[model samples]
Target: MAGQLSTNSTDHAHALARQVRKLRETRGWSREHLAIEAGISLSTLARLESQSVAQPGFFTVGAVAEALNVSLDDLFRSTRTNPGLWSAGYEGRDIDSFVASLLDHGIDMVADVRLTPISRKPGFSKSRLGEALSQAGIQYTHLRALGNPKDNRAPFWDGRVNVGQARFRDILRSAEAQSDLNRLTEQAVQSRVAVLCFEKDEERCHRKVVLDTVRERIVVEVQSLS
Candidate 1:
């Protein structure tokens, strides 16, 4: 019998994520091709492989299953089921819950952008977040150019600078920010990627500002990790 993914009913979303990746690789398709077949973007596929999202949305999960030529039941056949833990939204930032949430949502990567990616709390720092994300089955990348400061200044997105802080759109036009975004966009084309920063709420951070703008220009989805 072909091996079926045990989405049976449990909080072991991480293990299931591995199955998803394995199945994807077995088909010998790149993330971009899988995304196209699944009716999703390359970045979304990347997010699922790297993160342990427990209960991905229907379309995302269904699309992946279809692309892989696997039954949804096979993809989600679970040997374990733990409803209590994954039901609530994320709790305080050991980032345990948030990490789990990303796993559930099929978000596989975090591109850290805190100006100085350190944390007074151990888990909040760049390295720690990377480690935590890795443990949760997600990938992490820290782009210095994506960090705040020069990227956050006026005319951040484009040369057309309006009075006040530069919006996310402005920064993308800067040579440095633009280059970083181009790289990220290419990666996103091949993997699932998110802009990770200190502010859990992307609305307040430049990363989110940048992401919102990216959504406008690309086939992208901005999901909150928290």
Candidate 2:
């Protein structure tokens, strides 16, 4: 099953790569220009064209398709199916595009699991982000208790993800975190929700740990939104 899933995912990536490259060249659009118009990073565009990304996120592919003046179905003509519940990161994305992606996915609420709801990125700081989401008709809640402590985050950043996840599991056992986890689980059952973090890769992000923990208490499907 895993192998089949892997093969299907690869096929989707290759399909998107082929269409993106062909369409971009046909339209005479530079990679940088397309990336700028799509509000995605240059590296992401390059990786897609090179067919090097293992699992490109839905929003990332959609943005590229839209930038090239094509439909998503035209770019990825596949039978791949994914869950509605999602997780997202804004590592190298513009705030507008990030929020737009969430809106496109029909996300009604965002569970911010950042330990400190502060960001160096404009429009990402706690207050501004909440305001922006509110204006966009999306609800935002900062679940600080679910955040991984700074001390435990070093392991993840240092490529010691297992160590970080182990330590974060201990944090998840706390009363406060458990309470918030219950809330998150209940809310997820009621609406489309995505946990927010800073890392582009789910494996490196503590939110993956949080989502895994949430899965233990409830059944839900999760996909990453870039």
Off by over 4 Å in 1: 1-73, 76-92, 150-164, 167-171
Q: For each candidate, what is the lDDT?
A: 0.58, 0.76
lDDT of 1 by residue, 1-226 (tens): 0111122232245546656765666678777878888888777777677653556677898888887888888788831322210111122565666675666555545666566777676576766777777755655666666666754444433443332135545545678877766656655544455566665444444665556555565675555554
Number of the top lDDT candidate: 2
Local accuracy of candidate 2 as per-residue lDDT tens digits, 1-226: 0011122335445445645765776689888989999999999988887667868889999888788877888666532323335889999997899987886565656788898989999999888998877555456788888988888888999999999999899988899998888878876666567799999898999999888887887788887885
Model 1 lDDT at residue 41: 73
Q: Residue 221 CA error for candidate 1 (Å)?
A: 2.5
Candidate 2: give the clashing pairs: none
**What is the RMSD, in Å, between candidate 1 and the native fold over all Cα?**
13.9
RMSD of each: 13.9, 13.0
TM-score winner: 2
